[model samples]
Target: MIVTRGSRLPLYLAVPVVVLLAALPYLVAPPVTRTLVGLFALVVLASMWNLLAGYGGMISVGQQGFIGIGAYTVLLTDIAGVSPFVGIPFAALVAGLLALPTTALVFRLNGGYFAIGTWVVAEVFRLVTVEFAAVGGGSGASLTGLSALGPTLRGAVTYWCALAAVVLAVGVVFAIMRSRLGLALTAIRDDPTAADSLGVRVTAAKRLVFVVAAAGCGVAGAIIVLDSLRVQPDSIYSVQWSAFMIFMVVIGGIGSIEGPILGAIVFFALQQVLEPYGVWYLVVLGLVAIAAALFARRGLWGLATGGRDVRFLPTGYRVAGSQGGVSGGGSP
Candidate 1:
């Protein structure tokens, strides 16, 4: 058997698909582009969460805190006389910086406590945001800076930005998972004490992952504001965002780049179908998640690959015989 580090097949196929998707705004109707913006947002959010929980082994449920921070950053930037469109990256920067101090607090806890601490941190952010009346406080605020662009142009630009965000999120995770950081993360995830003993710098790796994930989520939040043209503290900081991330990652398959993308599409499809059912939509989603957890612990992608650890993105090594095709490999 021969061993290979990466596969070119998925990359070859993805180029054309991405090109077509990028051109969709010009080719499709306005409503279609509008809808896809939402989908792309989900893809970005899910990918970030997967990077944190699946690859980094840090299961955070308060990522919405950073989402809110991103949204508010856009609002603040607009107030400072900057275009909200131009403020997108600043939103990510702000979130990452904030995550620095937050890591010092959340890293103190382990296992379930760490998760709960993250949620608490998110709640604190929401509470503090509510105190700022300049940004509409408890009521929320809209991006008045966007008014300079016409509806058609705004929608097109937002669509493009959302697409770029998806690319950025997926590309970052893919690159990280293929680097030494990915190896370090894998070591920590499998056995933290052993990884630390082996000089993996477990805490540093976790902090980096935490900050990067926060930035990614912040980008998603900024896109959400652009898509909706509004941001409410309660809404942006809602715990529901975390739930959506978990559901998408769980059903799509965690620990792999393709899982979140597949999961986001499946989740978006289910949302479209079940949205008209009111609260039952949530009920059905919960039921489906439960079913997936029990029946397919590895997720839809895991099943599609027949539990062989075959990767479309090929971030990890693959073992193959002279006959060709993937034989065996560890999880991405």
Candidate 2:
């Protein structure tokens, strides 16, 4: 593998930007802080979905199942007198554990069957959760456990948790995509049969990617409920979560890390501006997504960069020019 030095411009620009964003709760109004929390969640969701479908070639529309699991995990722990803040990591763990058995069953199918099977799994999770009356089942329940904190403190804590979750989610994806596992994933994605023949543990790689994506989505779910202070099966487990993730990934650029982040930002921006238009906002979102799919299949980020080798988080090794240093290695 050739070693190369990636552009340092993004890192140089991102450091202070991240620090500013981290201190946003202290500097901004409550509504702005709340919106940033939601934005962070979208980034985590889009990035994880990209890793799963783009790199792993495992298209799963059932991620909302894990999202709901995370939300409910927070609820369950809170009911047991634990702080909801403490429940976030536990939510991720439970979601990951659930993925083990779930993957074992769903991995039996391939192609479109696999996609449909995942959706079926999500529905199963939703239906079962509705049967559990302890968590308000059909009607859903509000999280009263956070009542002890002042409003300002609650918002700040939620925002910080969201920030941390996004960081972890992105970090994990970058780490995986830049490692030997990433190379194997690339081989498997391009040709699974060939990859298997070449000694790549295709099943293990897929399973690992699937579990990580689930855990990331799970953390996003927990953050969502933590911010909203409520969780309902209908809303938390809605196919809409997966739909948004797909839209963001597809419109931003499926295979690139920066693409999802860009797509999420665009989606969030559009949501903020067009939300008051009611149903028209949905129409607009659909049109944008369709346009992106039809014209910019690599996504807006790809288009913006002229489909070059530009990457905010570089994943693979590239050979260097004799007259120049390594061309494109990403920052840690």
Q: Pick by lDDT: which candidate is best? A: 1
TM-score of 1: 0.94
Please estimate how well model 2 matches the true structure, expressed as its whole-model Cα lDDT.
0.89
Give Cα-based local distance difference scores for all models: 0.90, 0.89
Model 1: C-alpha RMSD to truth? Answer: 2.9
The alpha-carbon lDDT assigned to residue 205 of candidate 2 equals 95
Candidate 1 lDDT (Cα, whole model)? 0.90
Q: Point out the worst 10-residue segment of candidate 2 by lDDT.
A: 1-10
Clashes of 1: 0
Candidate 2, position 37, lDDT: 94
Model 2 / residue 72 / CA error / Å: 0.4
Shift of residue 102 alpha carbon in model 2, Å: 0.9
Q: Put down candidate 2 lDDT per residue, 64-181, tens digits, no spaces.
A: 9999999999999999999999999999999999999998998999988998899999999999999999999899998989999999999999999999898888878877876788
